[model samples]
Target: MNNAHYELQDGIAVIRLENPPVNGLSYELRRGIVDGIKKAEADDNAKAVVIIGSDRAFSGGADITEFNTPKVMAEPTLPTVINVLDSTELPVVAAIGGVCMGGGLELAMGCHFRIAHPQTQVALPEVKLGLLPGAGGTQRLPRLIGIEYAMNLIVSGTQVPAAMFQGTPLFDELVEGDLLESALTFAKKVVEEQRPLKRVRDMKVSHPKPEAFFLWAKTSVGAVAKNYPAPLKCVEAVKASIEKKFDDGIKLERELFAQLIQTPESRALRHAFFADRAAGKISDVASDTPTREINKVGVIGAGTMGSGIAINFLNAGIPVTILEMKQEALDRGVAHIKGVYEGRVKKGKMTQESAEKKMGLLSTTLSYDDFKDMDLVIEAVFEDMGVKQKVFETLDATCKPGAILASNTSTLDLDKIASFTKRPEDVIGLHFFSPANVMKLLEVVRGEKTSKEVLATSMKLAKKIKKTGVVSGVCDGFIGNRMVGKYQTEALLMIEEGASPQQIDKAIEKFGFVMGPIRMADLAGGDIGWAIRKRHYEEKPDTRRLYVADRLCEMGRFGQKTGAGFYKYEPGNRKPLHDPEVDRVIEEVRKEQGITPRKISDQEIVERCVFALVNEGARILEEGIAQRASDIDIIYLTGYGFPVFRGGPMLYADEVGLINVERALQKYRKQTGNPFWEPAPLLAKLAAEGKTFN
Candidate 1:
């Protein structure tokens, strides 16, 4: 059957696109559309043409699978298809609903008139994939929606509801319901009125004082768009629309779009887009695996982590029962949850009623009996094994049969925790990032005996709470923290070798990290890492005990909580300030070790810290802790604030050429004489083979 079907109704020829899901405009669909339009033009009884899509989408732009392929530019390309629609003698009206984006929107704008359902979302999100709209979107959107508004939508790649643009020329009319009937009524009226065929290309695009407006826009867009070239290209395209003829403007748009598609930044962004989707798939679990229902959740402990975890379930409209040993701790946790809602209400993000409704799902308790009926119970107690084991043992005994037992432990052995429960298959790790309510990453650590249903259900639940869930196999620190451990270790070692905290932070920040390791450590609390390190030292006796971190802990500098960490903080101020006393301590520690400090270059610092991550990530790949290299990238890009433009560490290493990365590690291995600098076997082998992790 043809992807697009042509049918006549009451003197109006309706063209319905039949491609499943979002009807991606491939060559076949493009041909079908062109044929539909010609059939309407040829039909003696048909007075008008109405082009639309399946209930799901009008068109979701060009078929991405056809990208960089000859079929994309085959007979009747997107531009050629749009041209045929524009030339049709009948009044062609676009009936848009669901998703209309990129070339889809461009196709709609090519028609004589456009209308959509009220809730339909419209966007030209090509910029998000590191390319501007190639199909006259830059030129036509401004003509219909004004220069400033078009620039905002095109540059930021934001989605807007069709209702928001009711008065704009982009939409001829918005139907309440039954789009076909309303469109038929609209088309018949157009026939009666003898409405002339209109084209977006014929419309004049104008901006008030074009030269001055463009100048101001360039300066503002340039400020936040240092790394991305597409947004600025979007600016230049829109600017050309205002200055040049319509045909010239579109020519400029196509040129800029083609150029961006080939750039490395665009390639990285495209890779990131695919990586995020691929992260959700587990190799062992089928996509059709059944997930257990999750209605009620129980959180053990009412500390910061527990409270944050509870808020996620509550926000998802799932009832949450939080258990704490003391009423004081429970009160504080409950109050913090309320305070969060109150803050959102004050910020105008949520109404008082909505906040109350979300808070209504929350309850606090002092007994595990309160969790007897919960579908899932997550223990967010102390990170120590003994405490977690005890909590899980009690939960396994208390929670009803088949209930999932989860631990929010960041760095402990998940398999050991799972063993504590009688039903090991039900025990999994839901490693939410700190301040769980805000962060998107949820590392669903699957134990050795974890059932496929439990893994599938945990992933489903993660989605309900609006998190990007990545599955991890049993291992210390799992995916994110495991790699971050190396990143942090290198930073501490770098500081000891003479790079100051501020200099190290600045160098990484310049390289695209949100915060340097030192600043992030200060924010997360230095004590957290100190405890983890102590565990490591115990597990592996050869681990160093007297690092610079231990000295900072001994000085009672925990982090933002203590107001003095590696860097000092004044009362009520969380910003790090240079402390000469800390410098003195570093010098004293260096003198005690009988080693003189030497100046370290920023390049060396980046190599040490980043190469540490790459090497550890390589080991993770070999061990099957992560499903693929892209999964590791997803963990870092979403959780650890890895630079999006450079892609993730694994991709970044591949881009840097594994040979160069191997050379860098070999250099550090020889120069620093630290066993940590030794290259992973996988990294060395890949470098030798001239291959990438991807």
Candidate 2:
């Protein structure tokens, strides 16, 4: 009696789901729904039953926390609750308003008819979390929509707008007004006309050759999924619907869902999903801090980094003023911005009109007078302390009072940049990844004197620009590039010690990196690394040198732009063309170091490259540069091209076991005699105690 809310209107039974916030189908809500259906079935006066939700959303999905609990997996689960809705003899109509996802969609599918408002979103996003539709979703979706569309939706886990279902058989009617009134009207029409019940499971599979569906799905599964078993397993579950009986398909889906829940990929993906959400919560900053609203922004550079940062602000509907010293440089920057926007237009991502509108948001100027009244100024000049300090001093003198000052320094010190300005409290780092408009990770560096207000304002601006803002303390390379330098150094050393560049690249590529170390270095331009190395040497000449490869840069082999670095590249194609010249250079370097060439295994190469990064990440964590291990994972997954299926470096380390990693590092340290291979103390302690980063 407590579970069901019975209301009689005319001769119809009204059952409203009384749960809050998307009506997540918890254990109590499931039982309440079942009892509501039973009440409608037993009432003689109720000619029809109309089920609706009081909240904006019908239901979000099954409770995520319930998945780990034992009580949920027992008898009378979600499937049983769906069965009660399916068994109702009277005409039943479901009124859906907001999000109807997962179990919410399953409940609507069981109804005799469904009506929804124009703003509702429908999806089965279980595949994103490494799961398939368990409660009749696999069996019913294909029956409502065809096999091809159903497979794509379930496999990709994409949500579609409710307007797309207009005039489709999936939804009975698209309501413009109240969802309940529409449901009631539809129910009255159905009862009066004595509409026949159409069960999804009873519908025959529409494909002419069902075997072809399985074959195509299998091909797609192999190409996209590679070694990961979850996506392929999802394909198999969907295939069951076309190949087997409805009940058999449901059983296969359940088995696959249960198996995937225990997989490393699923666990890692779930961790990543929640980690991204958790990054927004900062304990240091009060929620009440006044966010410096960024309307008009200024970028102090015209190079690649500055132009990309300006593009992001423009794309976000914020006006930008790109300041450069020379008219020729300003013209080149404008041309580059137009080219980038034109590429987007060519790909059908944006229209020509929209591109022109975005370009109109940008105003190029040569003087700091144009920066007046700007809300934020981001300095993205060359990585030099004097050049950066000059820009900061100029910005401090010209910018509007209380305007947030940001620097886009990848590895330079933020505290030193703040030292040049009188308002050190306002100076913060907004280190966007290369090609800032495309990359999602934005390292928000907080200097020693950076105020909490400035930190909060920087994060707010990062979110506004559609970037994941990860806060980091001041360090040489901050968090990402610092760890990357160590990883890249290890890969280069491996090449010096007889490992082939292609072999090393292939090993890590197999481990889910988009490209290997040498290939990535080539793509990012060798000049950048050369510049950083030169700066490092100039600043501290006596600081332990680790055999630099100056020959590559001297020969003008500055990666893909110059067509050669550690590998050769063809114009217009990203594929690496192995060069005999590079091999000769390696041989000459190897002789200079007096190293005997030895064969290197793929296993050893992967361990050296990946574990080196993980080891450095541990050091960053120990130094308090990174707040959490998950934050490091987020940076790699979003910023770097680290594969999502394996999670990030930290997750991979946990999977490999710290003890095994520490042993490898110790063995390599002794063999190579490189101080960089010294395992981090936290890594050693974790290995000794047999613990994980989590």
Candidate 3:
């Protein structure tokens, strides 16, 4: 298909890119632009040139599909095409609208003049993929705009509307009408007056006390850069445009861009970019599947989870009705949700009127009859199966016909819950993470009888509430929590074997996790997991085992709420302070098991925790609980605080080599006579065959 098209308008040669969706500059598109420029320059009748794109997008960026392919560096690259456009004799005007970003913005910079609509979103966001702009973006952008503005834009990879730069030289005019017509008129004015070529390359990058500002910028960028190097490199490249000559800065930009592309951080970030996009697609569900309209939502229970769940739909502009057994309980739930919004208002993150508007969408009830008008009803009651069955059965009888009934059960069986209702197809799970309005993950649990329309609508509603929706087959703990169960188990086992909570947390934190399992357990409250563990033992008797966590709950120390758990916390501070009493509890458990404590290394702690996630993830894949390896990565990255720089646990395992992982598991099995360390069959097979999950 023709990615770029050329047409003649009066005496102006108009070149427009036709790549559907986003007009990514591919090899063919580059060739078209280069050839079109040459054709326009050769024709004496064409006194000027105008370039434009469709209303949705002028261009988003370079065609990432061409990355690492011969087509990317194939002759007539983006720079080559831009160079010809920059040096063209006929005056050219860039007409920008929608999303014009990265290489697209770079191409616009090459034109003699630019005209855009006020709402045009313009950005150079290569920094998000862990690389600087390779094709003259860092060099030319600073020359057109000032160096400081260029630094902030390139470093953050943030979008700025064309109107934000209205008075700036980056755009010659802002057109509210047809951008193409305005651009053509701008081109005619340039030709009528015979305006000299206004190439961005000839412009100078100015700054007051350049050396001083760069010194400050380096220190600032370095502080926030953390494990990622691309942001700092972005600052350096923009600095080069000011310190070095323009051509020399271009060379340095290429060198820095090439260096960053090879880093593991860059590879992981690129994987993340693709994984997030791929997670939304369910292969079995066709794109044309009709979704149920969720105009109103209902939530049962007035506890933390249910209240938070109501806040999500309310924030999404959907009216929410929450039910409780008593009027006081209902009032408390409403107060908590309102307090969250009020806090946002006090923080200046939202206006008082805006917060009130959102809170106004919420309603409370004491009877199931009020849920009759709700298009969807989510039960966020306790984790007990009996409670869930009662809720589902009542919802089954009381809800309006065609209403989607969803359970917010994190680890419970969705299929069994579906069995409580006659229309099992309408019953699915919308597992929102803790503090639902704040966290991004929404694991849409698909039961055995879940209809495609229901599953699709749940995913759609997830996006409506600003959540990253990942579909998971009905299973105990679903995907994120199921894998985390194993991960936490490793931490517990390591503690029993010898390592202290601080030691394990330190090793994992150094490995890049923000919160270690022990600290996470404490923050979430040990009583939560203690209850879950009790439930596990009740449901599956054979897996019953005594552990140190039960001791913490027995002492009535439940995380931040109780001011103590595995660690002690000072009144206001949430920082974990080591407790010898907790260590004594662990020591007593080890003595009860008739085992002596052994010295454990940080490497073992890191391996056992991360590999535990990997092993369960493999089993999940083989069981078809997760769609693909990348989808699992997305779940962990978004839901849990798995380090983004390592991709997800599955991708990290692939990076570590599955063979090495199997060997480590075998070593642990031999060290401790536990059958749980046995390598998953899928993992062992993949390792032997030399394969990656992705």
Candidate 4:
């Protein structure tokens, strides 16, 4: 009874949905709604009816938790309750506010008329969960808004403001304030003027060329959807409106919804959604740990990484101070930021005024003297530990006592950097991915002496900057790059055994990688891997080492930036072109090693690269460096361009079976005699037992 609040005033029945926190359509709430509508229809005092919510949001959608439970899916259906609301003789008006999504929007479409607040937004986001709208949404939305707009909304799962609905015949009226009062006024107008009620399902499809719309939709959604089945199913639901009768279309939608609910893509996408929400939870760090409120930040470098990090802070409305040793370098960094903003403006992502406002937040200087009173300072200089340590030492003396100190070191030791600081507990690692502003993953490394307050503050700051922060204990390469190193080394060894760079690249790309390891190295610059390789050789000299490809770097053939590396690049175009010189260099290296390279199959190449990463991930999990397998999956999907449709490397491995992965590793170990091919003990044990990472 509490879920539904009913009152009769002046021969008008007002029914309000009272479920708190977005008013998700739960089982009890549905039953209460059906009973309330029947009571209003039978009462002589009630001449008409109005349905709305008590507070700001009308409804956020169906209770997502309900999908995980068996009771809701197995018990009394949602359609039965929806039919009760739709069939009532009295006129029913939905007064919507805030977000009306999923089943909430379906309920609104069932009403005779909809009155929305000016700021209200409506969407059916079922596609995000790999399900189509089940309860008359796919059938009704097209009827009310037409095919094109409806298809776009369903496919993208994007919401629009109520203002866009203005001048549209679907909405009866747009209300400004006090949604209940506006609903009552509209209800009285309908009764006094004897207005005819219009149901969305009863309306016919409206389009000049219905077949052309269907053809265009199939082509557009198919291109973007790839292996995912939800987008194409959404198109089928829309096409059903034109091809089938109203009730028949609803039946088709229900059938498709049930089928999609059982797909592996749906389960994976839903798992990802829940995993993202769960990533914010940190049990070791107290919830109330005091955070250093960062209103202004200072950056110690003006290179690519530094500029990209500055753009992230500026976009979040935090003022930034960038410092470079040379004035020319400072000018270039500023120009790069401006160019990025101008491109965004041209694409209508931002207005010129908005771009200027963000730019105004940035301040540049050549010395540390201008960094006074800054709440946080991020050092994004070279990869050398000595350079980073020197920056930490300078920042320790320059920054205020309570300010947070962070280093953007991808592979350097955070504990070593903390050792140089007077307040070692305040130092942390904020490893932003390359092209920092665009990449969503941020590895927040906690040094051995890192304080709980520092960890909590970094997590909160990641949310403020709109990035996914995964807390990682300090180790070599933290989480992502540490696993990446194992995978990349295996790929290079494959090349030594006669797999061409193109073959390796093509194999992984077919397996759903956005780019192969060799091409990624090209884009990141060949010098980066060469430098890291040199450092590794210095630290662990006894390990079997691959011959260095120094000619590429010595000739200034860095990568796409230098127009050549593993592959040749045309100016202004980043596409890879084969070069015989690179192949000749590789052949010479193979000859020096006394290795007779043979032709490698595509399947062998994919398993070597991807399984290597998954095998390393298992090691990380056993060592407790990563909290969960899903955490690694989220990191790869967001940062390393692992295809989302395939889930992630870990998920993909699970799909392929753990035993198969172990067998592949064993086969490689026997063939190559490389110690790195030794299947992780955990992986071998799990595979033997037929268990999975989950």
Instruction: Give lDDT per model, in order.
Output: 0.89, 0.84, 0.90, 0.86
lDDT minimum window of 10 residues, candidate 1: 543-552
The CA lDDT at 476 in model 2 is: 90
What order do candidates take by lDDT, descending?
A: 3, 1, 4, 2
TM-score of 4: 0.94
TM-score of each: 0.97, 0.93, 0.97, 0.94
Between prediction 3 and prediction 4, the one with superior lDDT is 3
| Model 1 local distance difference test score | 0.89
Q: Model 2: residues >4 Å from true position, as ranges?
A: 1-23, 26-32, 35-56, 64-76, 194-196, 286-289, 538-548
- Poorest lDDT segment (10 consecutive residues) of candidate 4: 543-552
Residue-by-residue lDDT tens digits, candidate 4, 1-694: 4477888878789988888888878777777778778889889888788889856678887866676676476433567767876788788889998888888888888889899987888888989988899999899888888888899989999988877777665588998978989999999889888888777778998789988889999998999888789999999998999789999999999999989988878877876776676677777767777777889899989999999999999999999999999999999999999999999999999999999999999999998878778999999999999898788888888898878899999988899999999999999999999899999999999898988988898999999999999878788898899998888887878888889888989888888888999899899888887888878889999855655255567667778988998899998999999999888888888888888989899988888888888998999888888888888888888899887776777887888899989889889889878777798988888899999886
lDDT of 1 by residue, 412-432 (tens): 998898888789999899999
lDDT of 3 by residue, 1-694 (tens): 5577888898999999888689999988888888788889888899999989889988898987887799989889888888898888888889999999999999899888999999999999999889999889999988877888888999999999989888888999999888888988889899899889898888988887999998999999999989999999998999899889988999999999989999988988999898887888999999789999999999998888899999988888999999999999999999999999999999999899989999889888999999988899999998889999999999999988899999999999999999999999999999998888789989999999999999999888888899889999988899999999889988988888889999999999999998999999998888878888888898899873648888779999888889899999999999899888998899999999886889999999999999989989999999999999999999988888899999999999999899999999999889877788899999999999999898
Candidate 1 Cα outliers beyond 4 Å, as residue runs: 65-75
* Model 4 regions more than 4 Å off: 1-21, 38-47, 54-56, 71-77, 192-196, 286-289, 548-551, 554-556
Q: Which has the better lDDT: candidate 2, or candidate 4?
A: 4
Q: What are the RMSD figures for all models against the true structure?
A: 1.6, 2.8, 1.6, 2.3
Collision count of model 2: 0
Clashing pairs in 1: none
